[model samples]
Target: MIRVVLPAHLRVLAQVDGEVRLDVEEPTIGAVLDALEARCPVLRGTIRDRRTGRRRAFVRFYACAEDLSHEPADTALPGPVAAGAEPFLVIGAMAGG
Candidate 1:
């Protein structure tokens, strides 16, 4: 099972507590996201753009201490993440004036 830790807001939106566990057949971020959306339909457009299917500007992806928000969607996740050893983190970026 792949583990995903969503930001608080997204957790609330998905009506889930703590980290979510998923069975992902593919190791790509896109595949994980597709499974996430399939499991939580309400989160369809919160993490990525509905039309472009791109990561949102304010949302960041991380795993194994690496920033993957800008990586290609088809890129395979880190070995730890793919092996369910590390949790994929979705953080809501903060802004300041």
Candidate 2:
């Protein structure tokens, strides 16, 4: 099982609390997001673009204390994340003047 920690807004949108657990066959970030979308259709376009399937600008991805927001979707996640030891964190970046 792969663990995913969604930001507060997304958790409210998906109507879920705390972390979400999912079973992903491939250990790629895209696969994990795909699984997340499949399980929570309400979050379809919140984390990623619906047409382009790209991650949102304000959304950041982290795993094993490493930033993966700029990494390719096909890139393999960290071993701890793939092994379900560490949770994949999706953070909503805050910006203000």
Candidate 3:
């Protein structure tokens, strides 16, 4: 199982009280997200754009203290994350004027 920690808003939308656990074979960023969307259909377009399939500008991904937002979708997760030892984090970015 892969642990995924969604931002508060997303958790609320997903109606989940805590981290989400998913079973993914590849454990790539893309695969993990695909599994999340598959499990929680309500979150289809929140983290990524629906049409383009690109990550939203105000969303970020992290694991093992590394900023994975800019990483390739197929990038493999860190050892701990893929091994279910660490949780992959989905964060909402703060924007200011």
- Please, what is the whole-model Cα lDDT of each candidate in the order they appear? 0.94, 0.94, 0.97
Q: Work out the TM-score per prediction.
A: 0.97, 0.97, 0.98
User: How does candidate 1 fare on TM-score?
Assistant: 0.97
Off by over 4 Å in 2: none
Q: Write one digit per residue (lDDT tens) for candidate 1, span 1-97.
A: 7899999989998999999999998989999999999999999999999999999999999999999999989989999999999999999999989
Where is the poorest 10-residue window by lDDT in model 1? Answer: 20-29
lDDT of 2 by residue, 1-97 (tens): 8999998888999999999999999999999999999999999999999999999999999999999999999989999999989999999999999
Which residue pairs overlap in candidate 3's backbone? none
Ranked candidates (lDDT, high to low): 3, 2, 1
Best by lDDT: 3
Q: Put down candidate 3 lDDT per residue, 1-97, tens digits, no spaces.
A: 8999999999999999899999999999999999999999999999999998899999999999999999989999999999999999999999999
The lowest-lDDT stretch of 10 consecutive residues in candidate 2 is: 6-15
Residue 61 in model 3: lDDT: 97
